[model samples]
Target: MQILEIFGIAVALSIDAMVVALCWGAVQPTIKASHILKFSLVFAAFQALMPTLGWFAGGALYSLISAWDHWVAFLLLFFVAVSMIREAFEKGDDNEECECRSMGSDIAWGKLSMLAVATSLDALAVGFSFAMVKTPIAMPAIVIGVVCAILTALSMLAARVLSEKAARHSKKLSLLGAAVLLLIGLRILFEHGVFA
Candidate 1:
């Protein structure tokens, strides 16, 4: 039962990453197998690390801001989502020809870590919640990390294949990704009484 509960939460959490991966694939249709592998590893490492970090932080900091963590998570997710929306609408054809291969291969560790940390900020709050619920720490964190890694890689691959066959659909894909982020952000806000 606990495993199932954790799995459900992990899936819910990974929806954002999976959607982002799809958009990444759509924007850069020339993604390679190596790119998939590299991104999956990067995403997985971060997803896995975030909850554990959050759990530790929770132990040390939850008492300091117990009432505000949810609001903070909501704000962080909203900010990130808003950024995605803004980027989606940006008119920078300068990057249309940019190859995913070069970028993936040359990904600086610092940037990768930054992206990982940025995307996984909500997981930190989720980790804090895990402490509140008294859930065992290690298993859920591992599950969420592994599941996100696999889902993100699969989404990227599917997006690449679809984009190759239907190049014109890239805009639609971006819109869909934006919608996912918006929904996730709104959901977070709603949970936090921001909408109430």
Candidate 2:
């Protein structure tokens, strides 16, 4: 594939990660640089690795991967979103100073890992496409990884800015973020014809 085509695909694949990062930013009352960098690196690793895996697996396992990847993503995202929303309404949440359900604004490995996998699912499919086309995977994978990392970080930064401005409105913003995540999950399901 041409460089531009590869770049386009990379951007398309990275949208999920970017959105997820934004969700984190919206839900997090405080933005930590360490968390952002760690999240970005983990996401980048997943994005880069999936395509390579798919490329190597080639067409052999494409169908199996494709059949369930979207559902997996939808499930993970939906679960997290619901958890965020539920936590928002939990008892003893009236303490505005409390970073309740905040996950310490630290890196929660479980959710973060799940987010990385969920966001990188599309890139796995893309890797399969690259394999089918016999296109070189190294360059494309690198581009996809780098682009995803950068976009996710940028999105998080934007969210941090918004977070700073809306610190007092963290509850409202968290609810909004959770709602958006739920929508994103449903969108993934709908896109995969899960409820069709």
Candidate 3:
């Protein structure tokens, strides 16, 4: 594949990660630099790793993985969305001061890992496609990882700016983020023909 084609595919695959990062930024009480760096690294790693696995696994595991990948992604995203929604409602004090501490307490590593996997499932399938076409995986995987990292970081930063600007409406923003996540999950299901 040409470099442009690979970059196009990388951008397409990174959409989920970008959206998820935005949601995470929107719902967080405060977004620290560590959170952004951690999220970008983890997401980029998964985005790179999944495609490589898919390419290696190839047709041998295609049937099995394709059968339920969408469902798994949907479930993981749904869980995060529900958590965001619950957190939005659970906050009793709108005017409460936020400590702006590390996000470790707010977002557990397990959840972050799940989100990473959830967002990268499509990239896994893309890897399988590349294998089928005999396309080189190295360049594409690197492009996908780099693009996803850049886009996710940008999305988080954009959300942080918006969140700060509308600090008084944090609850509404959280709910909106949760709703967007739910829609993304549903869209994934629909794309997989789960609803058909």
lDDT of 1 at 177: 47
TM-score of each: 0.59, 0.60, 0.59
Give per-residue CA lDDT, model 3, range 1-196, as digits (tens): 5676577667656655765676568767777888888889889999999989878876565466666656755665576567657766775465543333343436777888888998787567667655644567898899989988998888788876653444445566567756665665676678668779
Q: What is the lDDT of candidate 3?
A: 0.70
What TM-score would you give candidate 3 relative to the actual structure? 0.59
- All models: lDDT? 0.62, 0.68, 0.70
State the lDDT at 130 in candidate 2.
Answer: 64
In model 1, the Cα lDDT at residue 151 comes to 84
Candidate with the greatest TM-score versus the true structure:
2
lDDT per residue (tens digit) for residues 15-69 in model 2:
5576567656777777778877988899998999998887777656546666565
Record all residue pairs in model 1 with backbone atoms less than 3 Å apart, i.e. clashing. none
Summed over model 2, clashes come to: 0
List pairs with backbone clashes in candidate 2.
Answer: none
Write the residue-wise lDDT of candidate 1 on 1-196 in tens digits.
1666566556655655665566567666377887677767877777877778877876676577667766654454455455545554562442343233444434566776676677677577667655533456799888988988898788778875653433343334445544554555455556667768
Better of 1 and 2 by TM-score: 2
